[model samples]
Target: MSITVEKFVEEGRDPFSLEVVAGHEYLGRIIKEAALNRPGLALAGFFQHFAHLRVQVLGLAENAYLKSLTPDERGQRLHRLYQKKIPCVVLTRNRQPSSEILECAEAFKVPILKTPMITNRFINLATLLMENLTAPLVRYQGTMLEIMGIGVLMEGQAGIGKSETALALIERGHSLVSDDLTVLRKDSTGAIVGYADDMTRYHMEIRGLGIIHVPSLFGVASMRREMHLDLVVRLERFDPKKEYDRTGLNSETISILGADVPLLTIPVAAGRDIAHVVEVAALNQKLKQLGHDAAKELDEKLVRALERKRRM
Candidate 1:
């Protein structure tokens, strides 16, 4: 997903009336402070760790190290730093930009944001700015399980063993995607793909087994970073009154990101091989894509038989 680019400003303030600067993000927000200005909250520490290319700290304050420079010397120093060509520079304490720095900023298209926030408070917000700016792209929640060479998304209501099914699949040679929640993204060509978040990449929770690492137990082939979401199999308790599609004649699909994906509503009964059914469904969908429809062929054969009997 593409983000709307806007000018950098001080955090906790309105975005309008701010000077235009060079910055790009899916969600634009202003940073309140810089590492030099805000020393307590460790905003600089956070920025140092996140390593996001999008954030730029502006106008640093005067420390003993920086105060050594005279006005002209400071201007030269600012120019040298600006030459690095970061996303933007934040000017703390609402200080005015030097003519040389301003000219260099304008020339390089680097935005200079001014804010009254002291350094410590500014760093706190800068961390937030980086955190919220990047929206989740092609990621999933929880743990994904791999089984039978298929990326099965074990989905069910809360506590219905979605993660457990995924864990089982992983033990049986499938891969994990996400556990409880999965973030879905659609590409430009209308393909929906899913991925595991960096934090929750290969972790899963089983009832008695506690937290087990899928990749460690199953090896590299048992894990996948992303999958195309070829099928959606929803598991539900068996309803006696409901008329399930025993013949597999109907074509049911699930819509995600403006595209229809093959869907299977498998009922969970005692001793039912849900994983096997899902694998077969995925294989069948592949066959259908190659123009082999078993149900259609059977229907055609039955129709021909009926016509022959009528003629006889």
Candidate 2:
């Protein structure tokens, strides 16, 4: 998940209020770690336990310390900080870089970036940005929906009426996350979130309907930009030979970007209300999450009754 300094700058320029101060060409320096470091100790000539792999931050204290030093000592200390092979240096509070800081950065080929945000706020914001930039991501072929708070991923053959079913669910008050394609990413919480690409977000392509916007037609409540993937439903043409799970006792699951999610193989046939069935499935999944398993409870009750009959 390492990113180049250039990547961080490009992605964080507006948010971080970043402006290149020195070593413009050195923006390509690789960021081996996503954490930030304050070089106060290093600037004071204490190199022990220096976080050389992180992006160096020069806040007010460090800047003031440099201002107190003689020009010769300032240049020497700045040179030492850059020589530690740090990814880059960031000055918070939009503090102007001293001549010595600029000279040392260019001499050692270390990029210097400054942000107008305060030191503590900049650190927090940059931390989140780095984590998001490095999170594991994957692209899936499916229609994503949020039905009654449950995130469902409807996957199947391209023409198995996924968009049609999504439309029905939208009418039933469910929200659409994506149509035809979903981009999944494993966040820091170890949850899989499904989102749509910007190119066709909130747009569904029905066989004869061509392309239609969900939010525009059904109102904004009918569409969601992203939702955590709770269940996966695979739709297929009904085959009499195939044995479907009539009882919910045997649960199936699929892995999305390393997170295991419940999977259901739903048969699509004439006269079947797929939307109603999927909605029920989503509610059932929610019940299971809340520690209510109707199938298991019924089986347990039946077992207890059989045990009593045997004793009699």
Candidate 3:
């Protein structure tokens, strides 16, 4: 998804308090790339392998260099840079462009944005926003919650009590990331992050009850905007004859968007407290992360005891 210069100025927050100084009519220009480029070399007449598609940033050094150039030189350089179909150019540290640069931007229809933040800060924030706006997204029918700081995705057939269990977890102080449908995406570091569909965010539908606003009912702390997906829990109907894992000896994983996430299947029975069980599962996952696996430790202990008995 391409973000236009207009949207970037409007939706981008805080340090990116951008204002269109020129090329207002070209605000609709699409930023097809998710990277930013500093025009230091370009300003110095070096456009050999220029990334013109990215948003151009003019920092303190670039601004000073431009000031050092003769009026004719500056005009020619700005014109050449803008002729590359640049999406937009940002002036950082609230620096205003010279008349020649503004004229070139206007003539070439390149949007010029001014922000109060330093060059590095603006670049970092803008890069983050662009990455999120263009990140690859996948959708799944499930609920996402933060369990002991671990993102748990609950998946199961309809009417299998996914939402009910999520509700229970929320009541126990766990925050709900998303209900019904979850939008998952990978960040720059390759961690899968889950968010709710805008329409259904913070809302859940229970069996006997209608749609309920989670934040309103449980207060703001009960809801979360997004979370990194760390675990997946599938709730299955109990089958007496079905063979299930008797011990937590083997770890299972499920692939989501090309990432292998830890998976757990809990059979649902009439009197099973799935909510409490899931809470324990989340805590156990935390313990495993800390290098203590209860199942593995027990197995090792048993092996050591058997070796001692054999020696005796």
Candidate 4:
């Protein structure tokens, strides 16, 4: 996106006093030029040389102060600003302008808008408008890796094979997002998503391997800037006593970015293909999302069989 300039009369508030000719010209230019703009788009051009330059427009009191300034002072102020050919002058408060100010507006073709809002509110509204109109690129952290069909968040006590699994997944035709920490942001609809930070996009740290670049080892599609986290697979050493959930009957979960993501426990046992298992688990989760819960269906069948036998 391209950033568009907006003229705010007193913070783009309602009930603005605009020079009819100037407003017509400005709005006409905007309608002809600005195309396919996002909603709430705005960019402001503030004219500093206004009536009573010393008058600070702060919050609600701005209007009262402008009202106190003498009419001659205000007229000269508007004239000077109009001569500068600035976009618009924001008259603070709902204070109506004097006749001299209005006449100068009609003659010089400069808009005079009266706003009841403070500077902060005006600035915020302006910022929102600009962003919506432009759709600028946003900075983010963490790498997004597609393991099988699952969006696995590979996080652990550093040194864990996060990048390694990502590399393996990439070799298996999966994609890599970020390598280390991923910064997550919620969209307007509240969907949490991930993206990679530029500094550590393709970089990863393996103890003996040191820092390695992922893109160098794998092709372009192998790396992604960011992805939505659908699963969290924390790799830890295998514990013999820990009875791992061999069955997916009881789906486990972990909270990330305020959403409960399905979780899986993969024990890193020697000779076992941990990465492969994680990949399969992700695939299984995708299936579940499609309304095919394999474990639940099997368990339901077993329960019915037991009930039939008991009745017989």
The candidate maximizing TM-score is: 2
How well does candidate 4 match the true structure in TM-score terms? 0.56
State each model's CA lDDT, in order: 0.57, 0.92, 0.90, 0.57
Off by over 4 Å in 2: none
Ordering by lDDT = 2, 3, 1, 4
Pairs in clash, predicted candidate 2: none
For residue 248, give model 2's deviation from the true position in Å. Answer: 1.0
**Each prediction's TM-score versus the true structure:** 0.58, 0.94, 0.91, 0.56
User: Order of all candidates by TM-score, from best down to worst?
Assistant: 2, 3, 1, 4
CA lDDT, candidate 2, residue 287:
97
Better of 2 and 4 by TM-score: 2
Better of 1 and 3 by lDDT: 3
lDDT of 3: 0.90
Q: How does residue 44 of candidate 2 score in lDDT?
A: 91
Instruction: State the lDDT of candidate 3 residue by residue for 1-312, as single tens digits.
Output: 677888787867454778888888999998877789998888898999999989999999999999899999989998889888999999998887899878988788888899989999888888888888777889998899999898999999999999999999999999999997999998888899999998888899998889999999999999999999988999999999987777789889998878899999989999999999999989998898899999999999999999999999
